[model samples]
Target: MELNQIYNNAREKMKGYCKVCPFCDGKACRGEVPGMGGAGTGSAFQANIEAWQRYKLEMRTIHQVQNPSTELELFGVKLTTPIIKAPVTGSSYNMGGSLSEEEYADIVVEGSKEFGTIAMTGDGADPTMYNSGLEAIKQADGFGIAIIKPRSQKEIIKRIKEAEKVGALAVGVDIDGAGLITMALKGQPVGPKSKEEIEELVNSTDLPFILKGIMTLDEARIAAEAGVDAIVVSNHGGRVLDSTPGTADVLAEIVSEVGGRIKILVDGGIRSGVDVLKALALGANGVLVARPLIIGVFGGEKEGFKMILEKMTTELKKAMILTGCESLGAVKGNILRKLND
Candidate 1:
């Protein structure tokens, strides 16, 4: 079947939590609401809505061009596009569902194979998850990347060693889960840590490390200064800290502050290819999508995931064409046209 047909099929069949959050529950479950009685809540969710709207406008302007190429390189890995799958936790655990490690890994490997880019795995340093990842790594045909999250410095060291042993291409540290956890939410807990502690974790491994859940330029600069390989300017997809600024809002500042010293990646409420384009134009090396892939995964496993990747790359190529960008490098900060009141 054609890619769009597959996407629509998946979209049609997608139910339960697999439904689009922005469309279904975005109105009532809205964050940034003036009187929402929750911590880290309010407005951040609204930013996602705004981002999606802007994305639609931009994609409409660019969709009809021929040969919309979506090729880019990330962390020395040549990719057909800068778009990537974001890492999501509690998929079966925190989400009241169940997907075996092999099943999850297969979708990633297969999708990456189909898309000609690397897929990002979100399993942290848990022994069971790592073992599952190892099995998938063995079956994979050089079409993906793994970013294992460790709870502690020791776990980080062990996970990095394992990833190295598996010959994984890149490494990412989820500082978003670094230190403090509160039982105030229904989902997984976010661990907050100090720069010193995080620096120690980064220095623990020789692999290219990306500090995920970075929402501030100051933290991004710290990651760069510490010789980390990358920084995922993210808010844990708005799952961790509720009211954190959208990655797009602060992406340019982080990109400018980091000063090309290291690769920069951004994630959080990224649902489409145009979203990826906006991120790239605002100074991100690439963008990550997690929940959308989860929806795809729940809908049709590898096929569903592959459809999502195809959709984003297609739309991203459309954006590139209209923006007059022939290559990833051509889609620079100047492509961004901010709306001013």
Candidate 2:
């Protein structure tokens, strides 16, 4: 079955039929969680369906029909598309351990290589998961990035060194996940403290550094000025901040502030080609995806992920054609029509 149909089928399969989406568990649906809504059909598969539908509608323009190339150049690596699978940890938290870190990286590596981009391994520095990433890196021939959610300054440095030793193109420091409100509200421990530790890690690494969880222009500017290779404007899939603005809402601000200085990637609530278009228009260099990867893992594994990539790439190309854009560079700010406008 198609990815979208699978998502719809899953959604229909949910019990209780509450107006509130299970994805948000009532927070995002009611706006109590604020920017929690619009997180891509609640998973990757559904987001692909939504993107496909939007692509059909938006492909009337020359850019959309031509299907503009979604390729991106980050630091020195060239990618086939701007859509990246954001690294998500704690897969065992859901799915009863269906996706071990190694198996997940293997699938991501296969799909990313086939699609011509980098898949980020969601190790989060767990010894078991980190070991899995090492194996997957060798198996996939290192076609992806190793994202480390560090628990300490020393661990952060160690993770970056390991990634570099494995020849990873880059090491993403997921500092944005530091403030998970649910965990905090529950009196559970949160992530590490202070950007100083992160700054130290960046200094420790020779490889290009990507700082995720940047929200405001100040943070973007600061990271750029601090010499980060890329700034990922994200809120950790709304799993961290409770009422933060959607990454899209802040993309322009962050992009405009840091565009010439660093590569700006946006995540959170992006589910379609149109969403990607909006991000590019708002000035993002690329988009990162999370829950969709989960859906792909659940529904079809590696091949399922490859199909998701193809469909999203096709939809992005269609959107580009409709917008009269022939290349990623041509997706300008004028294409986005704000609510106030």
Candidate 3:
């Protein structure tokens, strides 16, 4: 199926929930948190796109690099690309229930596998929300990850054990979701963890531990000291707060503090392969994609999802080759200059 057809179907399916905007920038859906828009005026969400757009790729044609490698490996899981589907849930409430939580999980997990990458499933107030992802990952031979909300430590460890039982590639908590009143309203309270509390969770799990929503150098340092395998430089897609800097703006600072000490993944406003390359240049080990991929899922299911990944991989390689990057290792901040520069 063609790309246009996929979006057309998505627009029809996600009419009330999402407009399936030509560009999934935050403008069209501002303040629509029950849906897909960012928290308040949507400035944070727009900042994500703007942050990436401000960096122009410096072209260098006089290079021997013919093909660029997009290969990424996380916790020993080899991936053909660096795009991991961001953890998203609330199919019934947040997404219009066009697809159930289980259906979405199955498609994303299988789709990620199809693209030779892995996905991260989310947790919420609803038990089934997290369980659906676990079941799908279990069906896929534990090829996906489970991201829990920042609930109590005992509860988190219990969920971690569940992830371990499924032989998951990794387990994590969306510590950014601590401020989510929605979870508390539903009787499951989530809050920020102390450094010691975080360390306990890390020590309790044998599987690779990931701490999502690290936007500061201090937290990145703490996560490193606590011994997490990876830290996602994110702001919960600007859903948890308003008027915050985009993940891209803070990623470099965080990376400078703990780049080699811990694996760094980042999300927000990552709409294309060029965005993926930009994130890597800024020091992210990988990038997480959501809004656009959600369109892919709503429109064409697995094939549509894989098609987006294919386009991103192709665009990334083309961008890398033109930028004199033969591999991900060669991508550096020097290859990018701010538009204002």
Candidate 4:
């Protein structure tokens, strides 16, 4: 199915929850948390979009770069593109029940595998969220990454064992969800982890461990020092806090501090292939796409999501060619022109 068809279908399914705006920016759904916009004020969500707008690409056609390879080997997995599906949950409340918890999990994991990449499944306030993610990963034959919530060390380690049993490619904790009162109300206490706590978790897993929700240089360094395999430079899609800077705004700073020490991934307002290119230039080993993919599935199921992935990958290839990038590695900060410039 085409993107427009998928969106048109999703727009109807997600009617009141999401407007399914032409651009999926935060302006249309301000202060929407359980329903998909930013948590409060919606500034953080809008910031992610505005930050991308601040940088313009520099066109340079006179070069020997026709087919820039977007391929990358992330944590031993050969990927056709650097795009991974972000872990998302709560279709019932957050998405107007468009898809069942199990359905959303299955589509993302299976779709990413079909597209030659991994999907990161999410843990949420709902008890079935993590379980659904694990089941989906199992069905994919260990092709996906299962992201757990920042529950107690004992709890997280227990889930880690379960993820290992399912043969998941990797595992992670969405520490960004620490502030969700929903989790606490459900009798599952989650909070910030101390460096020592983080170190303990990293040491507990042989599976490549990731710590998502890092937005600052200090936390990036801490994740590196704590021995995380990767750190997702995200503000949890602006769902956790308000007035925070966009992922694009602070990515360069964090990369400058620990660019080579750790694998850096990012997600937030990343709506197109150009945004993906900008992420690589700033120093992301890879990136994630959430809202678009969610809406894709809502609109057209498996094909809908796959179409978005293919379209963005094609766009990234075109972007690489226009900027004279011979490959993913050739994309650098120099290809981007700042608004101030």
Instruction: Tell me model 3's lDDT, rounded to 2 decimals.
Output: 0.90
Q: Candidate 1, 319: how far from true, in Å?
A: 1.8
TM-score of predicted model 4? 0.98
Which pairs of residues have clashing backbones in candidate 1? 31-42, 31-43, 32-42, 32-43, 40-242, 40-243, 90-94, 179-191, 179-192, 180-192
Superposed Cα RMSD, model 1: 4.6
Model 2 residue 104 lDDT score: 71
Lowest-sum lDDT 10-residue window in model 1: 30-39
Clashing residue pairs found in predicted model 4: none
User: What are the Cα lDDT values of the candidates?
Assistant: 0.64, 0.64, 0.90, 0.90
In candidate 1 the C-alpha lDDT for residue 74 amounts to: 73
Over 4 Å off, model 4: 184-187
lDDT tens string, model 1, 158-217? 767777777667777677644313222333333555667667867776667777877787
Candidate 3, residues 79-111, lDDT tens digits: the string is: 999999999998876777888899999999999
Q: Write the per-residue lDDT of candidate 4 for residues 83-127, one digit (tens) a residue.
A: 999988888878889789999899999999999988999888876
